[model samples]
Target: MSQSIFILLILIPLTFTQSVRGKDCVCDLKNSDPAFPEKKLKNVETSALQCTRTITSEKMTDLDRLMLGLQQRVKQVEENVIVLEKEDDRNLYGAVSLRIIELEIAEIQDLLNKLNRTTQNYHHLSVQPAAQLEVMKDKMAELEKFDNMQVIKTNRENERVKRDLEQCKEELNATTAAPPTVLPARCGLGRVVSVAGPRTYSLTVFTSYTYGAWGRDAQPAPGDENKYWLVVLSTSNVYGNFIRQYGTLSTLLLGIGPKDTYISSTNPTTNTIQGPNMVMYGNALYYNCYNTYSVCQFNMTTRAVSTVALPKDTGYSNKFPFAHLAATYAYTDMDFATDESGVYVIYATTSNFGNVIISKVETSNPPVLNQTWSTSLHKRTATNTFMVCGVLYATRYLDQETEEIFYSYDTKTKEERFDLKINIKKMQTNIQFLNYDPRDHLLYVYSDAYILTYELIFQ
Candidate 1:
């Protein structure tokens, strides 16, 4: 009786121990804890079935190869079906029953049908888990790249803020030590105003042009600094009709009342104001000349013009004037821009080096290049560019209903941010021209036949 009790105790504990070890094995895998001791056991198909979701590039490649092999097999089966269709019971199976031959052919046909169906489904299966994950991985990699760029950009901005704070302190000290003087609005900086206008003013001087510039002239009359001037870049009108009037600098005043007319007295030719891009500063209008690295400055005061030659090896030296719309993507090799910091000519270098180069205008008979900032971002990536507070903002198409502020380069910080991603509600047509006025902090955009204005609130 004691021996029997002893055997029962041993057997019961042994069974219980096996049960506990089995539970431990399940717990280890379910928790995914590698620190747990590995249980030596078999028949774990349930866990294997549950862990079938892993997908990698190598696995996807193997899947693609398998799909290709299956396609080849399908093709082979199709060829066999053709061969079977030609086979005659009398010749191939002389002693075989006709019903047996038909059964064999039907079996082959059924197998071929199944293979074809499987072939059709192969793409759907491959795309769902593997191809979808591949695309997701690519997007994640791009996001990581942007994150690294953001870190660098943030560090640069911090240093710039520090410098600006010190400069502000110095300015405050100087102001405290000196006499105070107040400046009037006329002496202050000029900016674009948010004027809601679907109002169409006829182009009396130059009827139409695909690519041209129009902006508020620099104090046209003594107190009329807000008056705008229209300059046509091409003779080709909106309908593709060539007009001779656009051969000259078609400068017109834009406003109501008496000053709203063409300024024909200072008409210019190809020697000046022929560039596709133009910006007005003070009493002069600057242009990047067509098919040349020359910048023309047309003076509204004296009706005189001066041409400034860019470097001979400038990448955009002999390029044709930019078209408002292109077959594929919009390209702007030279864009004359102005902000509170004054006027600047933005262009790409000869070698390009995958960047746009900005040259500041200095006071000279023919304006001299003061300073240059080479943005590390490519020029072809943007549709239009504008400057505000010495920072260059570039736009990209985001769809018919939206446009995105995709890229920016701060001259002060020397930092480039390629993923600003600020969405601006805009029409989808090509944005031919973009100009920012600093006085009122408004962005003037020209797309198709519409002139749109948006208020830019700076923080």
Candidate 2:
């Protein structure tokens, strides 16, 4: 009886509260009446706004307005089917949105499950590999121990063996590096005959001026060149060293030096030249007795000189003007042209292309010509440089096309190489003279005071 009374007391209050919810109090009822009080309507308005905020859809604000309007319209009993139709779409959209949320949750749960499974599989792999790794580590340690033992055994003997090998290597090196027992004066290459002078030869200087009675004195002063001596060697080398010593100036070639300038090395009183350009045949010196036109054997090792005929005035005007200790000049023939031996003297001609005619030198014959060669070159001004055979020659031709610094007349091959372009541009002047030495491959070019050397690029 007491338990029944306790149950009745609890049911009586709960049943009374349920009855009050079905009545028209907006806050306490399960649903509100259309004619609810203002205060209750305010509460409903606040709750609706809260619900609107919890919805994430973009149309939630408009949907809340439509829902409010429908409730108000239904309260007024207005004739409107469009508002109901819109309300129906809102309910349908809510259903569709709830389904999308459910799908998203299901997808998230599926990804989480997959991740957990992967983590489990990783743990299982770790458990399976741990023992095998420990076994490998143990084997590796044992192999390392074996290697150490082998190294220790070998190291015990390696030091002594290395020392013995080093000692033997040092002994072998010392024996091989020592000099030989004896050395000879003349080594592997036998008896070298070293000479710096040219082999001796003769020359024929043709002159009409007699020095003893008619012409100028034999020994002339310096800066004077008229009468000169010709020194030719056996190798056909010519040196005019005899010029400054005993030459007569202002008349013929080979001008002599001043009285005190030149002294004879052999005949001091007679004023003979130092012997240069001597020809050595097989190992002996050759000396021709006199400067004559006819070839006559004066010594067993001597070489003779003959007159090559020339065309022009050969006695005075065309002779060598100074003494030189170099190759002797030879005229090719009787005419002012190329001779048989291919020796020639060049002269600039204002009439034709820097005209050049070959004239042979002989003591008896008249000036003759052998061949005529001309190059169309003219110089505008001085200071031009020309290079030939490592020597620089200049141009003195007062014309337009002469800008050469060096020039070469190759007789053996009959070729001429000239620096007409380079010499002109470099010097900014005309070339006057040129000398070339083919053996040394040197070209000495003159540009004002500058001497330039150009190595010939030969084919």
What lDDT tens digits, residue by residue, belong to model 2 across residues 29-85? Answer: 222213324564455456555544544444233333334333432432221222233
Alpha carbon lDDT at 321, candidate 1 = 25
* Model 1 quality (TM-score): 0.49
After superposing candidate 1 on the true structure, give the runs of residues whose Cα lies further than 4 Å from its correct spot: 1-208, 218-221, 237-269, 317-331
User: In model 1, which residue pairs have backbone atoms overlapping below 3 Å?
Assistant: 190-439, 191-438, 191-439, 191-440, 192-437, 315-350
How many clashing pairs in candidate 1? 6
Candidate 1's error at 8, in angstroms? 69
Give candidate 1's whole-model lDDT: 0.54
- TM-score of every prediction relative to native: 0.49, 0.22
1-459 per-residue lDDT for model 1 (tens digits): 346545654433222221246436321112121231223112233333333554344434434434443444354345434544554534543333344345445544655565566557555555565654555556544444434236656887999999999999999998887755523212233322122221122233333445555656422446555355555444432111111211111112121122322223233434444434567677677776544677767666675667788767665532422332333232246788877667888877656563678888864677888888988766666667788767788777767666677777777777888877766666535556677776655566555544454555332
Off by over 4 Å in 2: 1-305, 313-342, 348-354, 358-371, 377-419, 424-434, 444-454
Best by lDDT: 1
Q: Report the backbone clash tally of model 2.
A: 72
